[model samples]
Structures are given as C-alpha cells and as structure tokens.
Target: MKTNKIIVGLFYLPMFGLLSCNPQEETTPQYKTIQQAIFASGHMEQEDEYIISATADGTIREFSIREGDYISKGQLLVRIDSDVSNTQLQEARVVYNDAKQNSSANAPQLEQIKSQIDQSKTQLNLDKINYQRYADLRKKNSVSQLEYEKAELQYKASQSSLQVLEKSYKQAQDALQLNADRSLQQVKTQQAILNDYSIQADKDGIVLEVLKKKGELVRKGEVIAKIGSGKNILKLFIAEDDIAKLSIGQEAIVQMNNYPDTTFTASITKILPAFDEAAQSFTVEAAFVNPPQLLLSGTQLQANIKQQGTKKVLVIPSAAVIRGKYVELKNGEEKEIKIGQKSGNWVEVKQGLTEKDIILLPKGKSKEEGVAKPGGE
Candidate 1:
C-alpha cells in the first residue's frame, strides 16, 4: 500500500517525475497555475502619411520644400520643368482656340449657305418651268426647229448645272462639320497638357520626402514625393492575436519612448478586417482624444488597447504552459485548459484556471514525449 501511494504521488508531480527509486518504465508528472490576460505587441503610428506622385512625365523643375518641411494648404510644393510641355501645351491651345473660333464662325455661316441653296433651288425651279413651256411650244410646231433645239438645250443645261452646284454645297457642309469635331478635341487635349505641367498640393501637409531631384526625369503618376500633415493621430499595427479583441471606439493608451511618462489618450477609430499581407498585422487607427502638445509626426509609438470585456480570465506565460494544449498547475498539479488571446510572451488561459494563480514554468522537456520538463519556476 505504501508503494502504491508513492507511485500515485510520482504521477501527480509537476512535470513527469522520473520514477524515484521506483520500478522501471514508470514516471510521474507535475503541474502549476498562472495569471492570464490578453496581450499584444503593437507600434505607434501617425494618422496621415499620404504619398505624392507626379501626374505626367517631365523633368523636376523645382521643389518648394525639403523633407520634413511643414507646409499648409495651397502650398506650392513641387514644380516640373514643363517648359517643353508648356510650349507644346501653348501651341495646342492656340490651335484649339483657332479651331473653335473657326468652327463657331463656320456654324453661323451654315444658315447663310442654306439660304443660298434655297435660292438656287428656286432659280432652278423657274428655269424648269420656262423649259417646259418652250418644249410645249416646240411640240406644237409653233416655234422653228432651230429655235426649239436651242430652248431644249438651255433647259437641259440648267438641270445639269443645278445638280453640280448641289454637290458642291453638300461638300462644304460636310467639311464644316468635320472641322467642328476636330476643333473640340484639340481644346480638350490642350487642357490636359496644361494641367500636367502645374503641380499643386492637394491637401494641407508637410513634405516628408522629395522623391525626385531637380532636372530628374519622372514618369506620370510616379511618386514625386511623400507627404503628410503633421496631424496628431496614431496608426497602431496590432498583433493578429490581439486584433480580435479590439473594436471601434474602445479607449486606448499610446506610449512613446519620447514621452514615456505622458500617456496619450486615444480611441480606436478604425480597424481593418483583413490583416496586412506582408506584416501579418491588422491596422488600427486611433484618434487622440486628449493629445499631448509634444506629439509630432512620424514618432514611433506603442499602444495599450483596453479591453471592454469584463468577464474573468485565466492566463499564463507560454513557457509555463506545457505542450500546446495544457499547463502545469501548482506544485506539479497538471490540468488541461483552453487558451485565449496571445499578445506576446503571455497567452490567455480561458479554461481550467482562474486569475492570479501562481503557475510553474515547464522549462525543459524531451522532444519525443508529450510531457514537458519542469525546471521549477
């Protein structure tokens, strides 16, 4: 019976206790408990960091500011040597203006042409009536053959001339229409080129980087500079483990090495549903409800996102939790528990334990066995 009790004690010890002076092929286990809470690792970030790119290909003529220079709305941030583009644009504008003026002038003339055409048709109609009367006289033999032949020739000639004139009028009409279409197109092209040459800032911001140097060639839509307002905001990249616990409007505390004592008050304004593909983090935007005066742009920061869930929780260090599924309880007492949000070195223990429990760390373990070794925490 004493041997049986000792054998049972060996099994209940922290990690698997090697059978102490016991039979071969026998070992004991131990366990422990630990405090649990949700944890995460996140970096502090700025609210706005907008990228500025060029709209068209050109040489960098000039930049209004250097990197880190603060700017405001309506700032002349960058300029391109659009001299070539400008000249081209100017030429285009001249052509467009001339074409539009010509089109407008020709448009009014169309009515005059139509009236002239109507007058010509009326003259042709009068000639036809005269010819018909002459023919009737010839058929009645009232007129001599020579005179009748002359009259018949006159009528035929008039008909042929009218057809020719009509063709010419139609041709003029088509040419004017074509000119109007072409002119309108030229105007739009000039407008686009002119817009490309002038680069004005779209927002009130600071120039973070001058991507292109003066006289350097830049492609349209290529990044010409990086810009952002010195707006007081934090862009925290929360760890995937802790991302689920965060919700919009939850209060957060942001910290930076520059201002350790000063905790910047913030609230979650946005949370990305998807994780960043490269960083494996979820983006969370925080608004500074009570901002410190010292908060500046691009300052590295850390954030403490508060949890609103008030339900009690159990948690332990990952080291204390043996294996993937279980943890060592007090003095080698082993228990199986479900885990929760894992911030960093610590993981939340949701099941099989309570808060403030002192848990033992499973320091070492054999690779082959499911059990872990207790180095005695």
Candidate 2:
C-alpha cells in the first residue's frame, strides 16, 4: 500500500506540472488609430528621364555636353558627321537653282520663243497689206482673180503659223514652271534631312548618361544618351493581387535601403493600367512631399501605400482573429467576427465583436505569429 501511494503521488506531480505550464491568452479590445496599407518594392527615378536617340545614321563628330551637365531646351548636344548629307544638300541646291534659271522669264528658251512670235507678227502684217492691195486691184480689173486668191491664202497661212508659235511659247513656260516647283520641294526635303544630323536637346534637363563617345558610329534611332529633369520621384511595382488597393492621390510611406533609419512621405501620382510581364507586377509612381536632402537616381526603395487613414477603432492582435472571419473568445469558444481594415500587427473589428468582449489567442500561438494581411480577407 505504501509503494502504491508513492507511485500515485509521482503520477499526480507530473500531471500538475503539465497543467501549470499551459495558460490561455486573453485580451480586451481597445480603441486606437489603425492604418491600412499595401506594400511594394521599387526604385527612385527622375520625374522625367528620357533616352535620347540618334535621328540620322552617322559618326559622332563632336559631343558638346558630358554626363552630369545641365542643358537648356534647344541646346546643341551633338554634331554628327554631315559630309554625305551636306554633299547631297549642295547637289539638291544646284539642281533647284538650275531649274529656277530655266523657268525664269528671261531664260534663253523664252527669249527665242518671243523673237519667233515677233517675226511671225511682222510677216502676218506684211501679208495682210499685200492681200488688201490684191483685193483692190482685182475689183478695178487690174489683177486676175487667181492672183487675189493666192494673196488671201498666203495671209491665212501666216495667221495660223503665228497662233501655233504663241501656243508653243505658253506650253514651254508651263513645263519649265512645273519643273522648278518640283525641284524647290526636293531642296526643302533635303534641307530637313540635313538638319537632323545636328542633335539638339528637346527639353531642359541634365545629361545623365552618354552612350556613345566622339568618333563613334551611331545608327538612326539608336539611343545616344539619357537626360533627367533633376527632380527625384519614386517608382514602385505592386503585385497584381494588391494593385486594386492603390489609387491616385493616396499617400505612401517610403523607405530606402540606403536611408534605413528614415522614412519619407509621398503621394501617388500615377498608377499604370498595364502589367509588366517581366516583373509580374503593375507599375506605380509617387512624388515626395518633402524629399530627403540627399537623394540619388536609381536608388532602391520599399513603400507602403496608405489605403485607409488612421482612425480610432476597436482592434485586437491579429493572432486573436482566426480564419479571417472568426475569433476565439476568452470562454474557450470560437465566435464569428466581422473584420475591417488591418495594418501591421493589428486588425480592426467591424462587427460581431465589441470592445467589451475579450479575445483569446489560439492555443500554443504567440502574438508574433500573427502576420498582418495586406488586404483583410
């Protein structure tokens, strides 16, 4: 009986130790400010960074600006070798000038046509005088009817020849004028093509990069340099599942890897509608309200876009809420609870649970295990 009592005491001692080590975690909901946000990772970029490309294929004769140089709009940035284009332009000008000279009112061909017209007019007047004489002579019986008829036929032939000369002159003038107009258009087109060889800045910006050095060959449409507007902005890529929570004008908190201890505030300026297949995410852009004193382009950053602002609401540790729609009560029973916005490690209770009710953490679960959901389920 003594040994049996001792064995019974040991068993009870182990049981008591087990009961003492495990305890139910419970907490009452309290009202506090909660912020709901969506997280994204991205990098810093200039507000307007454009890649400048060559408009014409040529060797880089000279580069006026270097990297990190500030330039104004319409400033000449590069000079491409324009020997070929210049030669072509000169040839076009010669052709245009020749065409103009040929089409001029004083051209040799027009002068010859005018001379022929004057001669034809003089001959027609002489024939008309002879025809009038023959008519008078025939009426007076001084000349035969056949002689009068011959004079009349000669006069008509002179008139027809004069008309043909006048028409030919007009046709020659029109043909020369048409040729001159076509040559003028060709000259203008060549001039435009020549102008493209000298690259100029399209906007006021700083030269961020120069892809080709002097004397390097650049093809038409090839990127030659990069320019920045000198204003820093954040570019983010949010996952497809979380893109719905973002909107223009929403505020965001930005943190850079370089500035680990500091966080900057910004506002959503743009949300791109297209998805990037390479990134498997949607693009977003933000502008800083008060930017940091030292910021560089291409700096990587992480951002939290504020979807819901801070508000005083009943909240509990996220671990207390289970399966998103239910919560464990202090009385060891699971009850359905309506949830609202969530941020960080806390969740806002919208219905089914009140501040007066006590919430129990799941068995063997700690507060740290409750991860905040981006968008509350």
> Which numbered prediction scores highest in TM-score against the true structure?
2
Which residue pairs clash in candidate 2?
Answer: none
The residue-by-residue lDDT of candidate 1 on 275-318, one tens digit each, is 89887788877787766666556677655566654443344554
**Candidate 1 colliding pairs, count:** 26
Name the 10 consecutive residues with the lowest summed lDDT in model 2: 368-377
* Candidate 1 accuracy as lDDT: 0.62
How high is each candidate's TM-score?
0.58, 0.68
Question: What's the true lDDT of residue 23 in model 2?
Answer: 56
Q: After superposition, which runs of candidate 1 have C-alpha atoms over 4 Å from their true positions?
A: 1-48, 66-75, 93-126, 135-141, 144-160, 213-217, 229-231, 307-377
| Candidate 2 wrongly placed segments (more than 4 Å) | 1-36, 132-145, 230-232, 308-377
Cα misplacement distance, residue 65 of candidate 2 (Å): 1.4
